[model samples]
Target: MTVTQVALIKMPAGNEYFNLLTKAGIVFDYIALMWLLALTNGVLSPLFPIAYLVVMHATIYWRTKGAILSSISLTAGYSTIFAVQAQFDFNTTFVFILNLVFIWIIGVFGSLIVIRERKHLKQKEIFHELMFTDYLTGLYNHRHFQEQLRIMTRARQNFLLVMGDIDHFKQINDQFGHLIGDEILKNLGGIFRDLAEDYDAQAFRYGGEEFAFLLPSIEETRQISFFDDLYGRLSSEKFSKECLSVTMSFGIASSKSGILPDKLLGYADQLLYSAKANGKNQVKFESRYTYYYSKAKEEIAASKQ
Candidate 1:
C-alpha cells in the first residue's frame, strides 16, 4: 500500500468510540478477574484479596484521574467481599481494614506513576513542536521542510518547490530598524499561511527573510495563475506602521524524476537570484528542459569517468 493509504489506516478513530471501547474493556476485565477470585477463594487462602489490589494496577493506563476513579470503585467492591467474610470477628475485621489500607496505597502509587507518564508525554509534544516550529513567525521551520522533502522524494511524488525572499529586505531593515523588520517578517508569515491554505499548499519559513512553499500535484497552466494571485496578494498587503507596500521575489522549480531535494532547492535558489537580478518583485520559474539538461550532463560525466 502507498504511504498515504497506510497513514489513513493508522490514524486514530474518533474519541467517543475509543473511550467507550476502552471503558467497556476495563469493566469486563475487572469483572472477570473478580469472578475467578470468587470461584477459587475456597481452595485458596483468605489473603487472596491482595491479588485484587495487584490487578488494580492495570487501571494506570487510564491516566491519573481515571485510575483514581477505578481504584475507588475497586476498593468499594473488594471491601464489600471482605466485610462479608469477616463475619463479626474482631481479628478478621482488623485484617480486612489493613488490606483495604494496602489497596489504597497501591492505588496512590499507580496514580503517581500515571501522572509522571502524562507529564513525560506532554514534554515530548512540547519538544516536538519547538523543534519543528520557527520561534519568530510560528511557521514550520527549515528542519521540517527537510523532512517533508525527504518524505516526498522517497514517495517519488511530484511537487512544486517555490522559494520566496522579501525584496529590499535589508534596505527595509536598515531604514525602519530591526523591530519593524521583524514585524514585517511576522506579517509575511501570516500572508504565506493564508495563501498556502487557500491554494492547498504547505508553507515554511526557510530562514531569515526567506520562505518556501510546496504545491502538490499543481498543473503547469494553473501554476501561473496561482503565482499571479500570490503576487497580487503580497503586493497589496501593507507592512509596518507606515502602511508601506512590500514585495517579494519568488522562484519555483517543479520536481522531476531522478532529481534530488538539494539540487531542486539549489535550482530554485538560482531562479530566485535571477528574479532579483532582472528586477525584484517578480516570479521566476524553472524550465522543464533544465532538468533533462542537468541529467544529460551527469550521464556524460559518468561515461567519461
Candidate 2:
C-alpha cells in the first residue's frame, strides 16, 4: 500500500482521467480490506481506524471531490458491515453515527489544506516566471542571461556564446519610424524564439536591436550550417512593408577552460564588430586555441612526409 501511494504521487498531475482511475482503485482496495476485517473480527475491529486514516491521507491528493467520494464509500462500507454482524441497538447506532461523522471531517479538512497549498505554489511559479522573462520578446531577460552564463562558467562547460545585431537598425528606425522598428524587433524575437526551441539553445534580448544566444558546443561544420540557417530565416521574413528587408550580423566565441564570463562576452562582441566592419549580414566565429592546434598537427604531418 505504501508503494502504491508513492507511485500515485509520482504520476504526472496533468492526466485527470488516469488520476481518477488510480484513486478509485485505491478506494476499492480500502473497501475490500475493510470488508475482510469486519467479516473476521465482528465489525468492531481495532484496526479499522488505521484504514480510515489511510483513506483520508490518500484523499489529500484528490481534493474535495475525492474526499467526498471516500467519505461516502467508507461510511457505506462501515454501516453495511455493522448491519450484518452486530445487533441494531442504541449504543451500536450511536458509535456508527460518530464514525461516519469522523470520516467526513477528516476528508473535508484534508482536501481544504491541499487546495490552499496548490494555490500558493501556483502564485510562486508565476512570480518567478515574471522575474526571469523578457516582456517584449518573451525570451529570458538579460539578468537571467548573466546568471546562466555565470553558472556555465563556474561548471567549466564548453559552449558557444553568440552576439547578434540588426544591420543598419538606426537607419531603418529613422526611415520607417520607431513603431515599425518595434514590429521588426518583435519579428526577430519570434524568429529567435523558434530557433532556440528547435536547437535546444537559449536566446535573450540584450537590449534594443541586439540579441544573444547560448548554444551547446558542436562541430565547426554544424556551427556554420546553423549560422547559414539563421541568416536564411532572417532574410526570408516579410514585414508590414514590402520594401523592407531585414538582416542580422552575428559573432560566436567558443568557451575555453577557466575563461571568465566577461572576457568571453568581450571576445564575442569584438567578433560581432568585425563582422559589421567587413560587411553586414554575416557571421564570424573565433577559437584561437583550436586554430593553432590544427595548424600544429598539419605542420607535423608535412614534416613526416
Candidate 3:
C-alpha cells in the first residue's frame, strides 16, 4: 500500500475501517500493475509487461487522450513500492527520473517498431505476389481463380460467380494469329475490368480460354442490370486492330440463394457449355439465380398479353 501524503483528496466511504480497506484495495491494484513494470532485468519477460501496459493504458486512456497518467502512475507507484521494498537502500529519486526517460524513449521506439513492421509486411507481400497473371489479358490464372473463389466463400460475403469464355475465341486465334488474339484478350480484359469496377467485382483468368468473376453483394436487379450492361458493352465495343468487335457469353450464379462456390462454379460452367451448345454471344444465369431475368420475362409477357 502506498501510504502517501495525499493532502486534499478525502476518502469517499463513511466508515473509517472501510476507508482503509478501500485504500488497501486501490493500492493492491496499483501494486499489481506496478510490480509488472518495476522489473528492470526482463521488462517484457513472460509477456506480462504488455498486459500491464494495456490495463493501465486503458484505465488512463478512458480518462483522457495524450494524458500520461499510465506512465506517471506506473513510475510513481512502482518507484514508491520499490523504495519501500528496498527500505531506503535505493535512490528512489534517481530511479524515478530514469524510468521517466525510458518511458519517453519507448514512445520513439514504438514508432520505429510500427515503421519496421510495415516495411517487413510490404517485403513479404512482394514475395507473395501472384505469379499467374495473364500478361496479355491482365487477369489472374486458373490457380488464382480457384484460390480467390475459396477465399471469398470462406469470407461468406454474398457473391456471384460468373464463367466467361470468348465466343469463337479459338477461331479468332487461328484466323487472325496469336497476336490479334492477344490484342482481343487485352481488349476484353479492359471491358471486364470496367465491368468489375462498376459492380465492385473481381475478374480472373480461369484458363487459357476462360475467365471468371466474383461479384460481391449483388442483388437480383443489380445482377441483371450488371450483365445486361456487360453484354451490351462487349457487343458494341471496338477493338484497336481494324475496328474489330468483341463479344462473350457469360454464365452467372449467385450466393444469395445459398449456392456454395464449387457448386456455383459448376452451375456457371454448365451454363457456359450450354451457351456454346446453343450458339455463342449470349448470357445464361441459372441455379435459382434468375430473379431479375424471371421478373423481366414476366413483366414483358404481362405487357404483351
lDDT of 3 by residue, 168-261 (tens): 8788878788888777778878888888888878888787768888888655556667766776677677775643876677787766444577
Per-residue lDDT of 1-305 in model 2, one digit per residue for the tens? 56666767787768676567565666667766686767666455666676566555566656678778777778777878888876677877776777778777777877787778888999998898888877777888888999999999989999999999998999988988988898888788898999988778999998888899999998775666567567667667885583367877888998999999999999999988888887777777785312222143354456458
Lowest-lDDT window of 10 residues in candidate 2? 288-297
User: Per-prediction RMSD in angstroms?
Assistant: 10.3, 6.9, 14.5
For candidate 1, the per-residue lDDT at 111 reads 69
Best of the two (1, 3) by TM-score? 1
For each candidate in turn, the TM-score is 0.62, 0.69, 0.52
In model 1, which runs have C-alpha deviations exceeding 4 angstroms? 1-107, 232-236, 287-305
- Order the candidates by lDDT, highest first: 2, 1, 3
Global lDDT scores for all candidate models: 0.72, 0.77, 0.63
Pairs of residues at least 3 apart in sequence or in different chains that clash in candidate 3: none
Which ranges of candidate 3 are over 4 A from the true structure?
Answer: 1-127, 256-260, 287-305
By TM-score, who's the top model here?
Answer: 2
How high a TM-score does candidate 1 get?
Answer: 0.62
